[model samples]
Target chain A: MDLLTNILGAIATIILAFVVGMSYGGIVRKITARVHNRLGPPWYQNFIDAYKLFGKTTAIHHGWMQIMGPAFLMVSSVVTLMFVPVLNNGGWFTNLNFKGDLIFLLYLMVFGPLGMALGAGQTGNPNSAIGVTRGLSQMVGFEIPWVMALVALMIQFNTTTITGLMDVQQMSGTWLMFSSPFAFIAAVLAMLGMFRYSPFDIVGAPTELASGPVSENGGKFLFTMMSSGSIFSFVKLTLYVDLFMGGADNLIILLIKTFSIYMIPVLYGIVSPRYRTEQAIRFFWGWPLFFGILAILYAAIF
Target chain B: MINDKNSQKIVDIIQNWARKHSIWVLAYGTGCGAIEIPPTMTSRYDAERLGVRGAATPRQADVLLVTGYLTTKTLKRVIRVYEQMQDPKFVIGFGSCTINGGMYYDSYNTIKLLDKYLPVDVYINGCMPRPEAVLAGFGKLQEIIAEGRANGAQKYKDNLEWYKANQKKIIPSLLTTDYNW
Candidate 1:
């Protein structure tokens, strides 16, 4: 009975993530349009785009790996969501959080991109290959700071579990952003690359690489990629909230925190010019890496 | 079963509605009329307000906008792009040039009639249609999609032989490989 209930809860959480993430995406588009002094599509534009992609009647796939690309991404997003605690007070929202899942969560996050890379490799397009290489390189650059921040928190609190970290935050009455300021800064900086915005969006340079890794994907394949992206964005935001914002006690608060965290990248993307691939790698390794090392040192000393 | 069918119909209606609004156009510019597209997409007209955005590749694009006259060389490439697009796709023949070759009617390289080679869902007839006319063309396409009248993909498939023959008449070298769509 408990297992059945957990499964149902997980499904519900995935659905909620999809809806909220897509809505956030639509809102981001609107905000971007306004920034450009233009009237954008409605806040529900992403939902419409996703639905339309699914509605496309014909699609061409290169092979079996092409079919698995979006599936792997979806699995990774859902699995990451399952491991993260959504609310400060655990219930249905904390569907599948388990002790020491933080390391597993980190690996799962990379798995989707690896899968996508393999699929893109099969497309026989030089652009896809170039995009995948840039994406993987950017991933390596960002993960260093991200992992260091997580490790700093883990060492400081003596807990490798996300819920355990959240619980500590709740008891202290101070969010990690205040307590471990260096780690928070490093994480937020790393997130700019994680969100794949300008300066770090060398992989999917739409005009240059023709939307990069998913260049060959269309119809249902593109739809799957789109939804997976939304869900993954939500999962990443939720992870950040759990780590820094003390996690939300309810859905409204959760949305507020997640949306605010999401804007760090969106707003940053708007103003900045895209960096070349090597320049992006160097950017991540520079200040963000410095901050990550400082965070670890701060945790160790204090 | 009846309930299932009704729900499926509802899904179809919703899907059609969404597809009608979000038209991702291929970023391929074929002729001089391509000059008008940039303004339509930018802040002045902002085609994105109507959910019309530029797509990077033919695979992801929903509409192929062939602007102005297609020279024999360009038509070969355009046809290949058209074939590469997924089902439920559209072709917009922009300007009087695409409609009837415009000033290039006497030119041996320019194709006089575009519909002879590809199924065009909409045509904006102007020497060079303004961005407003381009937006109106998109608006008309949305209406066609909503009414389930955008059957150019199917028409292309049904009349592939004729399209191929007309295409072969111009490009005797046959530069395109069989995409096998």
Candidate 2:
């Protein structure tokens, strides 16, 4: 009975994450359109797009790896979601959060892109290979500060679990965003690269690289990758909320918190031009890296 | 009774509705009509609100918009792109040139009729159709999709030999691989 209940809870959490993530994507599109002084498609446009892609008649694959690329992405996103604590108090919303899951998550978060790179390498498209290289390079660039910020937080709270961090925030009546301001700043800056919005979106550079790694993918393959992207974005936002803000107790609060966090990247993307690959790497390693070092010093001293 | 046929029909309707609302157009700018596309996509016209958006590549595209005249050289590339696209795809012939070669009617190399080489589902007519006409063409396409009448890809498949014969008459050295799908 317990096993069945746990399985059911995991399924429920996946569904919730998918729905929230997809809706947030649609809202971001609407906001982007509004910024451009144009009326956008309805907020449910992404649902239509995903469904249409799902319903497409033909899906072409270059090889076994091409087929597995999207599968790898789906696994990574869903697995990442499993480790994130969706609600503050333990309930059906919480999946597999455990001690030291933060460090595990740091590795798991990057596993998808690496797996995708291997798959894309098999496609034989020069653009795909180029995209994979840029993507992995940018990953190296962002991971440093992201890790440093997390390390600072872990040291300050003296716990390596997300749930423990949330507990500390609750007990002290202060969010980590206020307590470790430098770490929060560094993490938020790292997130801009993680989200791959404007100024950091050269990896996919649609106009230049033909949409980068997934240039050859279409139909069901594209559908799978698109949903995985949506779910992964939700996982990242929820993780930030859990770490920096107090974890939410219910669905509404969760939405409010996640949406607020999401607007940072979305609004920034709207007004900015894209950075080249090296420029993006340089941008992350500059001020964000400095903030990460400052965060570590602050945590150690205080 | 929700028998197999009825259930299949129900699924078809839902799928068609979803497909109608999301049109990813791959614009093949073969001639001067390509200039009009910018205004159509940007804030002035905003075709995105109508569910007509640009796709970066042929694989991800639902509709192939052939903007303006297609010379024999460009037609070869167009055929290759169209073939690269997945099934249930569409070809839209944009501008008067595509309808009957417009001013290129007297040109030796320009293909006079588009449907002879590839099945065209919709054609927006003008010297260069304005963005409003382009949106109207998309609206017409949406209607056709909703009615289950847009089957250009199927048509091309059924009469592949005839289309190939017409194509070979213009370009003797057509080098695309066989139609796998």
What would the per-residue lDDT of candidate 1 be over residues B1-181, giving only the tens digit for each residue? Answer: 6469888787767767998889999856878888999999989999999999999999999999998889988988898898889888999999999888899989988999899999999999998899999999999999988878889988988887788888888888876566565
Worst 10 residues of 2 chain A by lDDT: A89-98
- Show model 2 residue runs off by greater than 4 Å: B1-3
Please provide, for model 2 over B1-181, each residue's C-alpha lDDT reduced to its tens digit, 9 standing for 90 to 100: 6668989899989999998999999999879999999999989999989888888889899999999999999999999999889867988999998999899999998988899999999999999799999999999999999999999999998999999999999999996466566
- Looking at candidate 1 chain B, the ten consecutive residues that score lowest on lDDT are B172-181
Prediction 1 TM-score vs. true: 0.97
Could you give the CAPRI-style class of model 1? Answer: high
Model 1: DockQ against the native?
0.85
Predicted candidate 1 versus true structure: per-residue lDDT over A29-132, tens digit per residue: 99999999999999999988998898886558689998898888888888888888878878445677677899888898999999999999988888899999
Local distance difference test values of all predictions, in order:
0.90, 0.91
How far off is residue B3 in model 2, in Å?
Answer: 7.5
Model 2 lDDT, residue B160, Cα:
91
Off by over 4 Å in 1: B2-12, B175-181
